[model samples]
Target: MSVILHLFIAILSLIVLLLFDYVRKIQFYKHAAKIPGPKALPIVGNALRFIGKDSSAAHDILLDIAERYASPCRLWLGNKLFVGIYEPEQLKTLLTSPKSMEKASLCSLLRPWLGNSLLIAPVPIWRAHRKLIQPAFNPQTLRTFVHIFDKHSKSLVQKMEEELEGGEFQVGSYMISYSLNVALESTMGISETSDSKMYTRYTECVNRTMELIMVRGLRLWLHPDIIFNLTKMSKEFYKCITWMHTTAHSAYDTVAVSLQYIMLMLASYPDVQEKLYQELKHIYGKVIPENLSVATEDLKKMKYTERVIQESMRLFPTVPFLTRKVVQDLEIGGYTLPQGSTAFISVIKVHRDEKYWPDPLKFDPDRFLPEEVAKRNPNCYMPFSIGPRNCIGSTYAMMEMKTVVAKILLKYVLKKEKIQPILTIKQRVEIVAHPVEPITIEIVKRLPNTFNT
Candidate 1:
């Protein structure tokens, strides 16, 4: 009788503790009850809704939720609360806040791949590193990179001349190679001729790891480190990360993806391409200069080219979303987002919001003109993001893009090629948004006397 009484008492104590914890969680939920969101179930919350879904599908669901609830809505991933903000007005409050500078918890998933680099470092470390690295992208430094950019772009043009024989070819593969070469040479100080095979393998691994991480992020079962490590995916992820560390200090996945989109958009819109070509011709006339070295002043003069790049990014941002964690209780648009909550900024939806962008689907480079840009909220257009944490290399990226695009346009005219699917491209979201199918385009050599330099 004594033993039975002791066992019963222990079981009852455990039950009471669990009930107390459950009550605490319920109280926490009530804090955000006023905020709009999908109906969340007990224990699992919204986890089941995203289980087994790919990143692309998950992205669509997020956009749908944003549309339904509008800005400053609540989201539950398991027990954690995420406040989704899509409107520029609400975004300005979150993005510009110094307290909300830290990356969201979801970014911790990239630890194995990116390590504690500036992209995902903690607040103090990130600030220090940002200060140190800011000079690397200064105007003087970026001007030097223009030479490197031109040299690699010329190599890409030469390769295209040799390989593109009138038929259609996948442009993405070539663009990736070109961008990788530029990234390695300009940033890592690694020349394309040195350790070419290692660079190729490392890039392949980085790409694969990004895809796996995206899949793992959606599946709640893989959240715990112990469970994630026990799987084959984790094994491969670590292996790639190890190889990447040995080869390069940084990754240019964003630059590669951006180039792919630029090429695709140029091919899809012939009139846009023609206008861009005309701009390039005005800069460098009929006789193409064999030794083409674009100065910073020259790049500044290419206003139309810059506008085209901006417009392309508006339609297809390399990073479709950006996330930050709230370090303190904050009120925005009438709702209180408690401390420790994650805030997601949907760059894609905000860029396409009809309220700010009239005919949002149309490809119009003029939207980036000074007067037009001034008409809307500054935060509305954030391809490289805005505020203090914005991309440090935005200028370098723009210069590199301009040089590469100019070189290609000077040599060849890109035409849309027909495949079975007819290039009805859908974006696949990994670390960056990528086209579901390879983008292939037909290239024709430009007439010799088209422009006079």
Candidate 2:
């Protein structure tokens, strides 16, 4: 009788707590009625429907709702309501607001891995880090690193040519390797190490860490601490974190890491790669002394390579979505959003929105053709995001991407490898999107003498 009574009391307490939570949510929704959204459940809200869907599908559903309501809309995940702010004007307001309205806890989860890196520090820390690191990516500074980037690109090309006797290879995987290499070398001033144990660990860690963050993002309502203690999932996450931190520290010392994806693409894409190689050969052919100081004039000439990198970013943006929270009762698109609401800016949708880009699905590099881009609105093409909190590493990321791509393309021919169907990468929201699988590609080489001879 005593045991049964205690059980009843515990159950009653849970019921009361759930009821109180429900009433609070109901009150919020009543006030938020002006904000359009699908009906909510008793306690979980739309989280039940959203929990299983990937980011792309969720955005698709949100788009449908936005279309149905004929304006920006709202979604409730548990008690937290997120309003979808789709209009360019509304986005401008949210992004430009002086207050920090865009704080998403998902970013908070990344602190364990990224540390105080510019990726997710508080605005002040973010500002300081951005300032300190800004010089590393200056056009002149980046140009100096061109030789360093080129050296690795050449080595990778040689490795590929030796491995594959010139055949069709999955070019996309190589792009992954190249991108990884660029990130390491450019960001930390490192070189590439062949398929070594440490290199393998770092690559694995990057992916695993990303996967853990995605899981945590999905289960934000259920505190990750509790989940971490109870499952093998947590073990894998911590292991990855350990490997990543150690490898990063090692790279800082050894000055060698892997640049996987970007170099891979350079190797596979013949036309772009050839053009970059010719430019490099022309610039370096006369035996200019290797100087760490690169001039602005050198970068100005690589216009087409810049266009290719920009186009690649457009097609495969690092972050597919951006989110923010409403701290107070706010109005957007004629809807009254309640305090403590969340808002997601669908980047993929915005980029591909037919109204903004004609033939949005097609990969036409010239769409960014100087004259054409001038005609378009800035909000339509924000892969690095925009406004005060925009990616501080924007200039650096672009320069690094262009430089690395330029270096590799200048030397090797990248062939398209047989890629399996693309799986949507579910990783931590960080500097860029990371795939779930290690992108595999066979690298082929074009002998340097052929072009000069």
Candidate 3:
């Protein structure tokens, strides 16, 4: 008799919650109706657009919606409202607001792997953890890691020797390995060689686990904890995680993704590459790139190299989208985003917006020239994002990418394998935005002493 009474009470509570949810959604639908978006079907809303798409296709679908609609437009994702903020003013309002400081529920998917890390922690927890992590990324501390960057980069170049005359080969593997080696050795003090059989297994497992996490993120139906646990994907996901060390770092994907893009861009634009090589020549005079050991002080001297890296990031931001949950009625892009709707900021759209950038598709590194940069709105270019919650590792990432790029350019001539415009390249945005096809470049060793300043 007691069990029957408990069941009746539970069913009553569930019905009450469902009724409340239905009423709550009316306000979202009302506002979303006023905003511009493709007409959504009942119940599922616009989820049909994402139903059969792969991650890259799903990414393109989102990009299409952002491109077709103006900044203040809305999309009904299931019963949820997602406001796309692409205009500069909208970005300023959403990014700077304390009310919008909370991450969207999608970020919670990372919690199973990352726990309540800085990436998905609540505002209060994030603030505290960010403060704690700041010292580790300080300029002084980052300078010390220049050696780590320098060491692994040289190893990276060596790993590509088989491909020296081996024709066009994928450089992403080399770059990812280099990124992992440097990050592990420096942060976790893992000196296990990235090339060793055991370390390779660990790296492979980590890669597979990340890929599964991305797949789950794309397939929205698997988002519920209970439902996800019932599937084979969940089993595979846990198996990979079990194989990985508890400390497998996930933050370095952006670094690896960005580095690969920069290498390809350099390969495509030789004149730009030549200019960068000249800067390296000026700074590291008589020091052959093959044997070059970049000092803490030398990092600052690569001004042109920094610009090249900056331009590459603008064209191909590793993490192109940023999402936050609206905590209250928020005014942005001339629209009122109701509380509980998600604010989806497309940094890529802003980066490619022709208003701020002339010849937006061109690969001109000089666009980042100080004089040119000063003329535009500061928020116009946010490869590492902007406002209070911007990426903390921006400085570290820049230094690391610059170190690797400079080292490689110093030794080998990276001839472009695919002669195509920057945007013409096929791309995928799952865990990170990267080319769908492997970025291939011919590796011809630059004759020693040819460009010694």
The prediction achieving the highest lDDT against the true structure is 1
Question: What's the TM for model 3?
Answer: 0.92
Candidate 2 vs candidate 3: which has greater lDDT?
3
* Structural similarity to truth (TM-score) of each candidate: 0.92, 0.77, 0.92
Cα lDDT, model 3, residue 123: 94
- Ranked candidates (lDDT, high to low): 1, 3, 2
Compose the digit string of candidate 3's lDDT tens values, residues 341-387: 89888888888889989989988888888899899988888887788
Q: Compared with the true structure, what per-residue lDDT tens digits does model 2 show for residues 1-453? A: 699999999989988997887687775667666666687786667777758766445445665666565446767666666777666767776777644354665677767666766656776787787788777767677566665545554454444555566555444434445555655676676667555566556656765666666656666554557755577777887778877766563222101112333443444455655666676666656332222223345556767666666655564566756777666666667666666666777665666677877876554556777898898887777777778778655665555455555444444455555533222322223324443344445444446546621
User: Candidate 2: misplaced stretches above 4 Å?
Assistant: 1-15, 18-28, 52-71, 135-144, 170-192, 224-227, 249-296, 417-432, 435-453
lDDT of 3 at 211: 67
- Per-residue lDDT tens digits for candidate 1, residues 269-320, read 8788888888877777665645666667778889999999999899889998
Q: Say what the RMSD of model 2 is.
A: 5.3
Model 1 scores what on Cα lDDT? 0.81
